[model samples]
Target: MLSHIDPNNQPTMVDISEKSDSQRQAVAQTLIQLPLALKPYLQGEELILKKGPVIQTAIIAGTMAVKKTSDLIPFCHQIPIESCKFVIEIDSTLKVMITCEVKTSYKTGVEMEALCGASVAALTIYDMCKAVSPQITISQTKLLTKTGGKTNFKRVPQPLYGLVLTGGKSKRMQQDKALLKYYDQPHAKHIFDLLSNYCEYVYLSARREQWCNTELASLPTLVDHDDDLGPLGGILTALETHPEACWLIMACDLAYVNAGTIEKLLENYHDEVVATCYQNPEHGFPEPLCALYTPQALKQFQRAKTAKIYCPVKVLQMSNCYFITPGLAQEIANINTPDEYHQVRHEHH
Candidate 1:
């Protein structure tokens, strides 16, 4: 029976008063194709057109559409939206994908809200980019997934990998931090072994000069594709190499990170957020080096790269990231210099 049609064949709204209230969520996605000629103008975070910053404007438009979904769609129930999030990405093929996730605590689903949000976001991109090139085409508007209410569902979790960053310049340390022995083994080898416990596959992120170490020759290594960008380049290389996998990244300089610290991070993982990071107790910011980054976060990193913002910490600061402080604050410490290394070594021993 059609809920929108009555026995008298008249259009009517479904009565949801009897339905029990429960948390509900939905996700929708759409893509916009830009002509190859216009791709050059689409810079990092903002494409400053005559209208405004393209990506930022699309985000606002998408959020507004989520709130006004009921007004636009006649049959959709007005939902009290608890939250709405957007993830936008521009791939190598010049296809821009916009995903909208909507959440509510109500009797009905928020699928329409998600769809509306994604549609509006795509339209906003088209509007902003039209001045640059009229060849922009929006397509693939559809619901990606939904949850809560009577039925609950989700897409498969992306594959996950462990990435040990071993490319730091180590100017202050005056030696390769990764090669320094902490537990009678090279720091890089120690971290790799730790990550192996939780991750299905592990790889080392290194620079050209660091890749030829005879001790590290047997292990899988990813040379930084953009060598000048430091840790940011390592992360980008990992994401670019395996776009479908979530990366659990650990820096070589983190001498105190152990199994318990990794366990705590994994236990407190937040899938909805782009990344789950440790909050630096000293600096009061998310520690970028030790974190679990989902595929959504990788896309944001791509956007940051386009905008010439090479700092991963800055990207995490701006995006929706879940941060937690370690029980032992010292566990997250980075041994950047010989003094710091000696101090940590003494403490551990």
Candidate 2:
């Protein structure tokens, strides 16, 4: 599983040619326990030793180390560091805390650079204060945070869940749309099974009448609220049910949606935006039925509900959203009428 090793078990540099350039950043921390003999050098927040200002010297050394990290580590890419910063402070427990932050816009991340910078800065501090006592100990060095790679490291992580919206009244179809079998099972079950492959959990949002009256009865279901907000009501119910997890909402009537479409949506997800959706080819607006909604997106929908705006697309337009082009013209198509449903069923088969 290691990227640095090749098939032949020889050490190799990871190929970054296929990776896209992004704004990557990493922060690393190093702790140094100062001996009691060096207490007199601490003048206010500044630590000035006989060799010069200790903090300033360590910062300079760390900056150099950040730029020269490729030389120190064999596998590290020579990243063009855009920014290198340091924060040095002494706590009440006489421990000198050194933190190094590195930023770069490149195909590879700068975590190693940040870690190297903090480590060298700790070493420089030890060298400067060694004249006072050889007991200066470099205690810990670790990466605090990193972003803009394949995955982001954070203190708290959110679980991703799937919500199949099956509560809509199919007035045009004149039948329960969720119960129609498109792929050897109910369409609602098809989408639920699709989502189960990628999400932590998958639930069906259905009306009270459909809860146990159809093929989807055996599945996990969330009864829609009686307020009659349609799909928006089901979305709000799921969000409120599990506020800690992000929801990927899929309409049961989407006949053309496949696993690839869902993968593309999740690949483009960004936490800063309220939602990530596809641009509706027909309307030039966000396709809310097949989109990923974050916890913050729930607030937007709640505000819209209070203002009597029940349209999920309108709510998404009023707030910030990231949109990607649908892979195919039918990727966002949902069958509302019996004619369209029959045509799609024939075409899909």
Candidate 3:
């Protein structure tokens, strides 16, 4: 049946009053081909022009478009959007991909809202960058995925990897804690196993000298590219190696961490945040070692590195990070000293 056509052959809005309210979501994407000359101006995640920051302005414009979708599109029902998220990425080819995801609990789907948001965002990018080069082009705009209603659908999940941080000096532990046996296997291996259950690829973050472990030799490893920076260097190395995939980072000393905690982290994951981390019960700050870092977080870390700031926790604290308290406080317990390690080992055994 035609949704916008009445018996009189006039465009009409479909009556959705009889339809039951259900949670609905839609994701739409658009690509903007940026000029090569303008690529260098994109410092970190956004470019600043006379109007303002390019990506940030586009995000605000997209959100406004999502809310005004019905007003712009004839016969489209106005939806009270529960949430709107935008992910903007610029690739090596100077192509910008803008994705807008909209969610609502309404009778009709939000495909129009998502599409409108993406289209407006692309246009805003073009307007902001046009002074630099008019060669910019809005290549494509289409709905990537949607959910709810009778026909629920989804695209494949984004490529997400895992990084197990084992690059620390272990000075407090008085030994290489990563090689310490926790469950008849190396501590690094145990954490690797936990991350492997959720990620398609899992890598051990280690120093060059620590690569001698026979068990870790067979698995993928991201050796630290820089020295003296500790876990911050390892995280930057992982981000440099895999710039596209989000990294789920876990420290080797987290002896009490289990698959449940990892699952909860994934379930509550927020893509828009720089990083999603568990709040340290003792410190009341984000636990950086066991967290999800998106590309934005990586960019922020790189900026911090250039400024001689080497603390990952400080970076998360300063950026747009999401922190949640774990269901079990012990899930974030890190076994730093030999006594603590021994106690945790004995308790588990």
**lDDT accuracy of residue 77 in candidate 1:** 83
Off by over 4 Å in 1: 1-158
- The residue-by-residue lDDT of candidate 1 on 277-326, one tens digit each, is 89989889889899988888878888999999998889998887768889
Q: Compose the digit string of candidate 3's lDDT tens values, residues 226-294.
A: 968988999999999988888899999888889888877775565656888999888798889999888
Residue 35's lDDT within candidate 3 is 86
Q: What is the C-alpha RMSD of each candidate to the true structure, in Å?
A: 9.4, 13.3, 8.6
Ranking by lDDT: 2, 3, 1
TM-score (C-alpha, index-matched) for candidate 3: 0.61
**Backbone collision tally, model 2:** 0
In the range 196-308, model 2's lDDT, one tens digit per residue, is 98889999998886767667888998887754999999999998899878888999999888999998888666565688899988889899999998888878988998999
C-alpha TM-scores of all predictions: 0.56, 0.61, 0.61
Each prediction's number of clashing residue pairs: 2, 0, 0
